[model samples]
Every structure is written in structure tokens, then in C-alpha cells.
Target: MVRSLKNPKNAKRKSKGSKKEDGSSSSNSVPSMPAKVWQPGVDALEEGEELQCDPSAYNSLHAFHIGWPCLSFDVVRDSLGLVRTEFPHTIYCVTGTQANNAPNSIGIFKISNISGKRRELVPTKTSNADTDMESDSSDSDEDELDNEGPKAPVFQVRKVFHEGCVNRIRAMTQKPHICATWGDTGHVQIWDFASHLNALAEAESNISKDASTVSNQTPLVKFTGHKDEGYAIDWSALVPGRLVSGDCKNCIHLWEPSSDSTWNVDSKPFVGHTGSVEDLQWSPTEPYVFASCSVDKTIAIWDTRLGKSPAASIKAHSTDVNVISWNRLASCMLASGSDDGTFSIRDLRLLKEGDSVVAHFEYHKHPITSIEWSPHEASTLAVSSSDNQLTIWDLSLERDEEEEAEFKAKTQEEVHAPTDLPPQLLFVHQGQKDLKELHWHTQIPGMLISTAGDGFNILMPSNIETNLPPANATA
Candidate 1:
């Protein structure tokens, strides 16, 4: 569930003279300070200026860099309890990198004690060490002066060599120890990282970060079935070990879990989209149902039990539909982000060809790199973009004309938006360059982890209004 207003700070903009939406106001007028909210896709920086994050917007923010930028990564569900609301969070993440000249690798990281001095106000790694962006944690933090026993945060990496650069990486939800990767060499590989997981947990590893000679680099199964490199891949949530992969050639393959710890990938491919499939999401509730978005500007719903054709399809956007997130909590709700930086929410029950759009917003100026629904909230979703911003939105919100008038009078903002910026837009996170993908931790209520050109960020937004008390709140 979302709060009445996304940013609690925004409520301060209202004057005591102005009536609340429910017609309540203070008996005595108390003027407030100017309300300053950055409008992305609309605001531009002047000369000698740069964007800075309002640190109060975050609960706990920590950033770490892998030597090379990872194009994709997945948070491994930890046994640290499924509903973590406490601080000093620990998480395991698996990622594959796309390096320049260096050999690519898959790193399983144990990032722990991800807590720092809470900032009353802060921004990028540039503004202060205690800020929004990353790099406080590295592969080897030996030389940093922290004689006081892990003061900031620490990351332990067990990296195994990979053949080619990984285009995408995903850990199977049912079996987190087993993972799959899509490589630029038109190869799809499945790996069992039980030993790697053990080594990371034990703070010991034999696998060198760049050595391919180690037996651990070998994948349990590799299929060169796809004609070209692809980014669309997903493990089924309904069925353990079941997987689905879609490629640039518009061919999708199904992997049935075999008893021998191997996969039986069908030789025949599922064909539906005319362009490259950009992303895939299995139905959180139904094992056989899944969804795919493509460069063809459409989203397709497929059932593994049905034939190659999609069970249903929608012309989703004007440009390529870069990503689609199927809401796990609200099964009928689906959200999509496009290459054009516009994102929309849809109610799948209105799956007809004409219109199913429940909400739409064009706030980002570049292609949407990744989009995901909050596993904990049915109406909330997050989107990352090439515009270098990640935005959180709650579809349950609507623009309050009176609230805006008060805010506008205090801030002196213009009358119209770039066609009325959806009030549902809650928070905007910046400071990552060449941003690629982001994911919310299913085990942690409000925690999020994202990968970009700079590295990775693990932050919980203070303003997003989660069910848990503030991280600093005492028991």
C-alpha cells in the first residue's frame, strides 16, 4: 500500500490556510518554506551545475563496484528471513559482466553490514562519502582505514570465469543455487553455483576472478540453439527448474527440468514476435503462463502448454517495448517500460486488442533499461532508464489539484507538465551512469539493488512509505 503522498516532505509545502483534500486545515495560518521537487525530463542543469540527490529520500543507501560494469544481475534470496525490516542488511547477488578488454566473469557477492552514518541531507558519491551513489565497498577493501571493525560496509566476491560477456543473468527462484546466463556468443548456459555459494558464505573461494581453467567455470549445460544473442530469459516461478528463453530471431525455447540435474531444451522454438524479444516474465501465480515484450513494440502472453503462437498479444507502445513486469501480488496488473522512456500500467483482464491501459506516464527522456514490480506491493513499480534516473511509481495515486496549487505557489513552478507528469511518480534516484537494470529484494521489505556502469547500489528509499518503521527507529 502507498501513502497519501509519495514524498512525505512534499506535505510540508502546504500552508495552514489551505484546506486538505478532506477539507481539514489549521485554525492559525503557518506559512511553509518553498517546496522544491526536481522534475526529470523537464528540468535542465545550468552551466557549472550537476544533479544532486536529496539524501533524506533514502533509508539505507550503499554502493559497491565490481571491476567491470555488469550488464545484468540477480539478488539471490537469502535465508536471513523473508521479511527483513532491520538494519545492517546482508544479501547475496549473482552478476555477469561486460568488460572492455578484460575477460568477463560471474561474481557471486556477499555484501554485508551495508549500513553507514545516516545523512540528514546528501547526494552523489561526489557530494560526500555518505551519499546516494556507490563505491564504498569494493572487491578488496584492505587498505581503507577502518580499524574499528567493518564500519561502513563490506563485499566478499567469489568470481568464476565465463566464456563471453553475459548479456543477461538470472538465478532460479525455486533453486537459487542454480543459475542461468545468456551470452553474447548466442549461447545459453545453466550453472550450478552451490560450491560458489558455499565458498562465499564461508568467506573462502578457490575460483580465481579471471581464470577459466578452474573446473567451476564449466557450465552444467550450454545450448547454442538460438541463432543470435538475446537478453530475454526467465525461470518459471510456478514450476521449479522450469525455464524460458527468447532471442533476437523471435524464437523462444522452453527448458524442462530433467531428473539428472540437467535441462531438456526443446529443439523447436516458440515463434510469435517479429522482432527481438527484449524481456520475459513468468506468471507469478500460473506455471504455464508467461509474458514477453519485444522490439516490435508489442507485449505477448504465452502459455507453454499452448502451441508456438501467443495466447494473447497487445500493441504495447509506439517504440520498442523494452521491458514488462507482471505484478506478482495483483495477478491481473502488468506494467511496461519502452525505448521511448514512456511506461504504462495495464489490467490484463482487459486484454483485448483495443485498450487495456490503466495508467501511463512519460517522465524519462531516454530508453527504459529495466522495469520491475515490487514483490511486496501490488500497485507499486520501479523503472530505470538510459536517462540516468531510476523512478518509483505507485499506480494508486492521482494528482490533487489543491495540493499542487499550494506546492506550485510555494515553489513557483510552471502551470503544465510535459503533458501532466503523473502524480503517482514518487521518487527519482540519480547518480548512476549508463544505468542498466534494477531489482527489489523479495526477502527485504523495502530494500532494492541495482546495477549500472558505475557498479551496484543497495538502497531503501525513506520516502517510499513501506510497512516497516524507519531504519533508525528504536525497538
Candidate 2:
């Protein structure tokens, strides 16, 4: 069974003001979120709510919710290079079934675009005779979501269909309607929503009596080369169909689309790491360059043309390196997370043949699972941990001389004082366990979404506009 929810009260709240220069709003007020009526761990829905029935007997119970991390910031350009204060009104969530079931799937959800203008719900008359009519009305609304962009803030589960259990799923920047996923199946699949999203939308909306019909399961493209199920996959930003994927077998493969609609793969996998290549990323500006982190506690940079050796390598962590993120704006800067529960930032220009880490973050108490650089700001980054928490870090904040002096007086930790202190932890998202991955919304600067064992969470810091300065203001 599947469930959907919406609170009319939340949709009617007005946006405070225009975005500020620094990407935050001048108004400091954070609109309060609706009270969570569904208690944690409860899978049942309230009365009057319709239950979506499916013969597959998939587990639909999960604790999914949203949160506010901060009140505000100034405005900045989005990943699309557009300056906007709002995010899209949809989310793609990868969901899984119970331990005994193999009902893995991805859900398309329509959510309130709370980052901008207040979107209100249309008032409807309630009548017992209108029960079936209401269901049809809901279907019609979903069809509109597929045909047109969001016109109002409507919270609903648009679709849920089976896809195998994928470890990572990423929507493309160049093509938002296309997404790529990889996992234990040793296959990297590319899905094109343009070919089927509208079809699914039309099928569901046209349902007069049946709502459980399954949609097509075919993917646009599939690539197989890894010795094991891939753990990481990324599409290049500068090049359209160029992609890279790594797996538990310590092998990395580069993929390109051929003229025949088939995938051309690197015959020889990029090899160097002694352990599983846990994560990989393509350089935003460099078409031929990419980076990968491994369980071997090392991070390596490779050029597609020269697969014989890494362009650069580092002993990044004391324990297994789980993930690494390239600074989108700062080409030479990168951040890495490890099983030791530490976050380190390094400048490739300054890294010599030594174990010199420029900065460290120690807030997470367990292994870090994911790390990402904010698309809007060069100095801002986000990370998730096995400790069931998501944290946002801003490197722009600097420690004063007094704090530096106090730290030196307190402990003689090293011969030389650390060059930089830990970045400021801007937000901490709790109440979830074993978070697997987290990502910043490309269109919305401050909004983020995360996936965990319990379910998925869409989080936005309160007063996200306050993070930026006014358009007329100078920073």
C-alpha cells in the first residue's frame, strides 16, 4: 500500500521577500513546518486516506519526512547557471522493500515548492457521493504534473514502480529528465523520463477503475563491464553522454554513447586502488578527468586518455575512504570522507608527497557515507554519516585570532598549528538512521534530499533566502 499527504496550512504561507546578494533573504523569519502526526516507525495512515493496492505485496511502510536546517542565506546561481530563489516541486526517491522481499523501486513524488511563492490549494466541497470523483480528480492532477510544470503546491505520490535495488541514482544536469543508476547487479542503467514519465502519467490518470496497473520496466541504455556490482557512478558535466563507474573489484570503467545507440566501454578498466573503489566523480569542467575514492584509504585522479597512471593520488584517510567530492567552482579543491568519521579538505595545488591534510571535520561519530559540494557556493559542502545524521558545512566562516590562541594554549597537539580550522557546521539533520546518500537540489541552492534505511527525507533550511544578500546589496 502507498500513502500521500498534504497540509493546506503549509501551502498558503507567503514567501517573505526577494533573495539577498549573499544568497540569503533579508527576512530572518523561518516559517514553522507542519506538526508530524505520523509518529516515527508507524506505517499506517489516517482514516479517509486511500490505500494504494498492488498484487506484488511490496512493503510500503517507511518513515519519510522533511526538516528545516537553518533560517536563511543570500542568492546564488544554480547548477543550471540561473539565478533563482525557488526549487522544483518534485522529488525522485529510491525505495527498497523489507528484508524478505525484493520489491525495490523508485517513487516519483510531487511536493510543495516551499522555497518561493506561497502556493495555495483549491477549496473543494466534501460529499460522501464524491469519493470516486475525488480519486479521479487526484489522477487528473497527476496527469497535469506530467504535461505541465507545477502550478500549485500539491503533495502526492505520483508513481511508484519497481527498479532493482540501486546503490546510487543521479539525475543529469544537462538533461534533468534522464537519470542513471548502478548497484549490486553489476549493470549501469540509464533511464529517460521523456520516453516514459508522460506515459506513466497518462496511464495513471486514464485509470477509470483500476489504479494498480504496472508501467513499462525497460531502461534506455544498459552497460555491463564491472567484475562486481558497481558502488559508484557519475555522468560527465561537460560532455553529454560520457560516464564513469567503479565497483567493489577495484576497477573503474568509462562509458560513452556510440552512434549505434549502444554503449562503448573502456576495454581495460582503470586500475590502481588495492581495495574497492567506493565512489567516483567527474570533474565539472574537465571532460577527460575524473576522481575516485576507495576502501584502500586512498583517492586518485585519472585522465581517460591516460589510464596507465593516476594524475594525482593521496593517502586521504586513516581508515577506508568512502567518498570524495570535487569543488565545483574551485577546480583544485576537493573534500573526502572516511570510515574513521572524519572529513578532510585538500588543495591539489598544495598537496605534496606527504600526509598533509589542510582541514578536518570531526562532528560525525560514525563512518561517513556520502559527501557533496554545494552547487551554489564554492566553499559550502554537505556530508552524511552512518551515525544517522546529515550535516552541512560552510568553509567561508573563519575562526578569529582569539580562538586560535585559546586552541594553542589548551593543547600542544602538533609542532605547527593546523593551517585551517574545521568549517562551520551550518546545519545538522537528525532523526534518521544509517543514511546511505544525500544530495543538494541542483535548482534550489539550500534544499537537500537524503536516503536512509528507514526511508527518504527532503530537508530545507528555514528562511533559505536569508542565506543570500538582497539583489541591490553589495557583499
Candidate 3:
């Protein structure tokens, strides 16, 4: 779902125009100012000197803001395969400006190469429009002429969706395009760079030479199945035009986009979770199956090919399950976190009719808010808690043969070990008075991003290092 972090200060002005006596005149006349375009990576920095920040100074602080009073950040690379300091390639923060009802106006900044200079990079507005156009055209021609390989990184701060305050934002893909999940007026909306005009110019340059496909400007699509607040959605990887969504009403609806310009409900309401389904994830390998975790203290697996009942149900927690994730690399693996101060991983293949448990984790003292599997490394899992710390686990280590034999022979009490070594803990920015949400960047595997309740600070993943090799090496 795509949502604009920028608040509309001119909403009243927009509303005022709607009240004009002559509707026809109002409709025909274009306003004096051009409509503000929604650009995701476009920066709002004030022009002039480059801004900088020190990563080491704040690295030890556990909690600190990179740019005071700025809202969003992202990370990207340049043509030489070098990480650019001026571009916030991974994270984004949304700080609402309180002036002129600009509760949604946001400042976008990026982490800098200089450790102490993680500041905002503002773009300048030039009156020489023709010159700029020529420059852009020349750049396009150069890109077209060169067949060196992958293109350089291009980043900008884009204003995606502007409505009410966005409660949650998740990326479905990465550039040459990106999609953001947004919650607005009890509906779920997905905004994509592919849907916007500003993105067309960028997309045209990025198309591969041997491709036969043409890009389409589909704008944004709104999914309104949830009568109340739609909480979560998972895009289908196997089936196109299909999505699974959960809402506050404890219902899960499967949707398919039909040829008639409307999304149709493909299945009946899949109901079983006693409370709100906070999250749902589709299995990367098993496209017909998916997992769902709810606030009702249960996790269930559903098969799209089957009927309404869950294929297998597990009452794996003592409290509300806040989040759930499927290991894209592991076909049968499922992870769920709960308010009971614990997280559990279950193997769908190991589930037996009377077995009450599979594998249990007790790491956090508070509810586990988010859990994700590392995209690059399958066995590595990242979990975040209300305690404001992120723990990374390496689950690749194999057990000793003797220990495995003993564990297989022992009872549940003897097999379960509570004193096992803790995962590597990386303390994220915690000093924020209120923490709202945390997410990992889909494109940049190791990058983590978080938002606070006041919408003040957005923190990027600590210890970020570029995987791109040095520029001088030939392909």
C-alpha cells in the first residue's frame, strides 16, 4: 500500500474550490499553480552546500536522530558501484510540519558518507527550463548509447499517497520501481512509481534492450474489502492479479483483479481467528498456501485450493500475535510473534494432529512487533520488539549428532532448553518517546527502518556497508 508521509496543508484550499457556485467553470479552469506531483525519491532539501553526518558518533548511542526535524530517508548507489552518501538509500522518516495545517509536509534526508554529516541534500530550482530539458535529453541519449551494463542508481523523494496520516508503509518491490502500502479511510491503497508520470521518464531509460514489453500508467488502485480498517495485505507471487488481505474485522479476503477494471472477491470470508488478523504472508514456494497470525493467540495456515477452514491450526501463543512472517527460503517454516513476550517458529510439515508445540522462542520482555527473514541469507532471522531492540539470529548451525539423538529421545521438558545463547542483539534507536512501526527494506537486504508514534524520527539500519565491489574492476 502506498501512502504519502507529507500532510496536505492546502486541503482547506482544495475544499474551498469545490464550493464554487458555478461547477462547470470550476471544472474547466486549471488552477494557477500546477498540481504537486508525487515523486518518491525526490529530496526536499534546501539548495547549496552538501549536508553530512557521522555514523560512528551515533552508532554507540543506541538511539539518536541522523537529521534533527527531518522526516524520511532512503539509500542508493551511483554509477561507479559506490554507495553515495547524499542518497538515503534504505530508510525513510516522516516528520509532520505543524505550520499552516501542514501536518503532512515532510523533510526527506539521507545518510552521508562522512560519518558526521548525515544531513538533508536539497535540490535547486532553475529558471532555465529549456536548458534543463536539453540536459535531461542528452543524458537519456547517453544512457541509450551506452551498453556497458547495469545503469547507475537514481534516487528521489517521491510523494506517493496523500490522504490521512499513514499508519503503516511497506515496500513491495525495489527500483526501477517501488510500491508502498497505505491505510486510508478504512481502505487499503497501493501506490507505485510505475503508476506516476514522473516515473515514466525514469522507467523508459531503465528498460532492458531485449525486452518486448511496454510499460503502462495504471495510476493507483484502492482495495476496499475491509469495511473498517484494513490492516495487512500480501501480494501473490505465483498468481498475477491476486492478493490476500486481513482487516480489523477478523476476516481474510482473497482478491483477484478482473479484466473489467475491478477487483473481484475470489473466495468467501476465511474466518477462524478469534480476534483481528494482524498479519498474513504467502509462502514463496507453495503459492497455494499462506500463513496468518492473529491477535486471538493463534496462527493458522490456509490453502487457497481448499475450503474456508485452515489446513492446519496452531494455538502457539498465550497472548495476541502482533506479527507473522513466512521464510521465503524455507517452504514449511512459519514465524509468529506475540504480546506474551515470546516468538515461535513452526514447521508446517512437522505439525501432527495432537502435538501442541514445534519450536518456541522467549527473547523479549514485551510484545514482539515485527519479525522478518533475511532476504539474502535464508537461515538468518531479524526480530524487533517493543523494547526497541532488534535481534538477528543465525539458525544455520547444525546440532551435534548425540545432542540430536538425545533431543529426539527426551520429553518436551528435557528437550526444551531455556538457557540457549541469545541472538546477536543490535539496539535500534529507542529514545523516541513513542515507536509506531519497524520494517526491513526489500531492496537493500540488511537495511532496517522504523517510525515512531509522533512521526518525528525515522532510523535507518545501523552498520550499513555496500556489497557492490570497487569501481575499477571490470565486469
- In lDDT terms, which candidate is top? 1
RMSD of each: 9.8, 14.4, 19.0
Clashes of each: 0, 33, 41
TM-score-based ranking = 1, 2, 3
Model 1 over residues 81-144: C-alpha lDDT tens digits? 7677666777899998887577778988887776633332222233333321332322122225
Better of 2 and 3 by lDDT: 2
Candidate 3: regions farther than 4 A off: 1-156, 174-184, 195-219, 259-262, 353-358, 397-433, 442-445, 454-475
Best by TM-score: 1
Measured with C-alpha atoms, the lDDT of residue 21 in candidate 1 is: 26
Instruction: Please give, for residues 214-326, the per-residue lDDT of candidate 3 as tens digits.
Output: 23333356666676665566766566556788877888988766786446775468888878888888888876888888877888889978888799878878888878888
Better of 1 and 2 by TM-score: 1
Candidates in order, TM-scores: namely 0.80, 0.66, 0.57
Model 2, span 53-151: residue lDDT tens: 110111011124322111011111113323335343343332222222444444433344322222112213344344233222122121333334333
Pick the winner on TM-score between candidates 2 and 3.
2
